[model samples]
Target: MSTTAPRQATTPTSTGWSLGDIAVRRVDEIELPRQTGPWLLPDATKEVLDEASWLRPDFADADVPRLASHGFAVTAGGLRIVVDTGIGNGKTRANPAWHGLDTDFLARLAAAGFPPESVDLVITTHLHTDHVGWNTRLAGEDWVPTFSDARYLTSRTEWDHWAAADLDEARRQMFRDSVHPVRDAGQYDRVDVPEQGREVAPGVFLVPAPGHTPGQVAVELRGSDRRALITGDSIHHPVQLSHPHVHSCVDLDPAQAVRTRARLLDTLADTDTLLLGTHFPRPTAGTVRRENGRYRLLAEHGSEIAATAA
Candidate 1:
């Protein structure tokens, strides 16, 4: 794979990108400025952000930095796979902003032409509150699988970790509502990928990218000539592209997170593999490049092609 020239920075709409035969689309749930607390990233100080000037306007403002929580709808191998469901509606949440959300998430998905039932599989990169909230929905007095016909795929390590974790009530409540219901419905599949990568679907694979969560994995898509990696919280913001060592506060293992981030950035730098950040603001997809002996992201417009040959 080869590198591509940077394209003019364009605003990221709810548009999708085509990777040869596969189509990847973004199903937006929420996009807001990054919370002004160390709860997200303690190292993301104004001084640190000031150095990454590219993050302004779209990612970080003078007052508030932006972060997005959305899901990707991957259509490949004749399958409709929904990766990482965002926070669902009408559920109790510890965070005030996430509680009782009434957004038209399902409506937006349908508007994007992907109804819940039409989804063949739902892959949770990790079992986090925001990532797995849409796995179930409030139905009458109990929660039920939102994608009634889709099979749920979660890493075995993630499943076991949450299952046996000594979590607080709030986190336990999240599992009871979002994950348990799917497991009870017999639709949940525990994927035990012992190696770094494993083919989960035709031309699509799961690459182990742990640290954000014990079992966090990045979804890789290989089309006829192009490839893309859906980075699931491995690198939350573009700022990490410049400073891979600055880990998020929520990272389960800070040191390991740093290692994972550095490895991924080094491996993909100056390569054709498109990097699709799960929490990055507008123009969320890009390719890594080395500049001034450091790494940066060359943001890509959906229609832009790789400048170099594979």
Candidate 2:
């Protein structure tokens, strides 16, 4: 079988949002196969998606919701932070679409001006296979931490839950190669986040965002002029904004996920804070508004800062 990666579908322009002194850039990884939406969020049916016309052209195609895997690179307070790592270049994954793939993820990151070694912190919104895959890279026969100088952070609750769960071989392999290597290198730290949230860096906070995962936390980037929230799978797609009850197929607690989504939308409704979804496709940042007693994203594209080649 051929082992070449498919040509990247996204344009090479760098898209980023400005938060006063802070800059948040989108590092393209791979636009997920169209099947990802149906498989991951089965409840977001075509009929349901049709209700939100604003979702078309950008967030979703005609019938199916489009999703992409990427990370948010933030430069704030003299600290460089990455919100979540996308599926790594080469890793064994149970999901056929995510397994043993090769892509120029690091090159894209560098083009956006965040070389791995230059990153100061990597905030893993939660410990999921795709979110944590780039935490390590192959070193001879073993995996090693990708960010040698950076400290990895996750909620203490998230770590402890996964630590005790009976992980399958795929999950175990993920930790063995990606998650554990960072910890083994003494570069991993778990923070305790309360109801309000915990500030990891200047103006960056980790707010309690449970239900998706017991320990899931949404990142809040508060700036002097405006604020943005980095949703860590708490809100997977734009359809969820319209129908907050539409839950992901893998949600640990569907009911709680609904509640969390409701609370998050309520907080962001008719506000200036930009909502950045961890799995949202292109034009990934937007503002929330209450429309006809429901929520919808007013899509926002960032200013182009640099050019890259796929």
lDDT of 1 at 172: 86
lDDT of 1 by residue, 1-310 (tens): 0122112222333477888888788777776434522358778777878877777766777743457778888878888888999888888988766777776777767656677888889999999998999999988999999999999998899888888889998898898999999999999999987666888888889888889999988899998878999999899888888778878878999888889889889989999888998888777888889888778888875743221111
TM-score: model 2 vs. ground truth? 0.95
Candidate 2 residues lying further than 4 Å off, grouped into runs, are 1-7, 10-13, 306-310
Pairs clashing in candidate 1?
34-65
Candidate 2 local lDDT, 74-165, one digit each (tens): 98898888889988968988787788878888887888878888889999999998899899999898899988999999999999999999
User: Highest TM-score among the candidates is held by which one?
Assistant: 2
Candidate 2 steric clashes: 0
For each candidate, C-alpha RMSD in Å?
Answer: 7.1, 3.0
TM-score of each: 0.91, 0.95
lDDT of each: 0.80, 0.87
Best by lDDT: 2
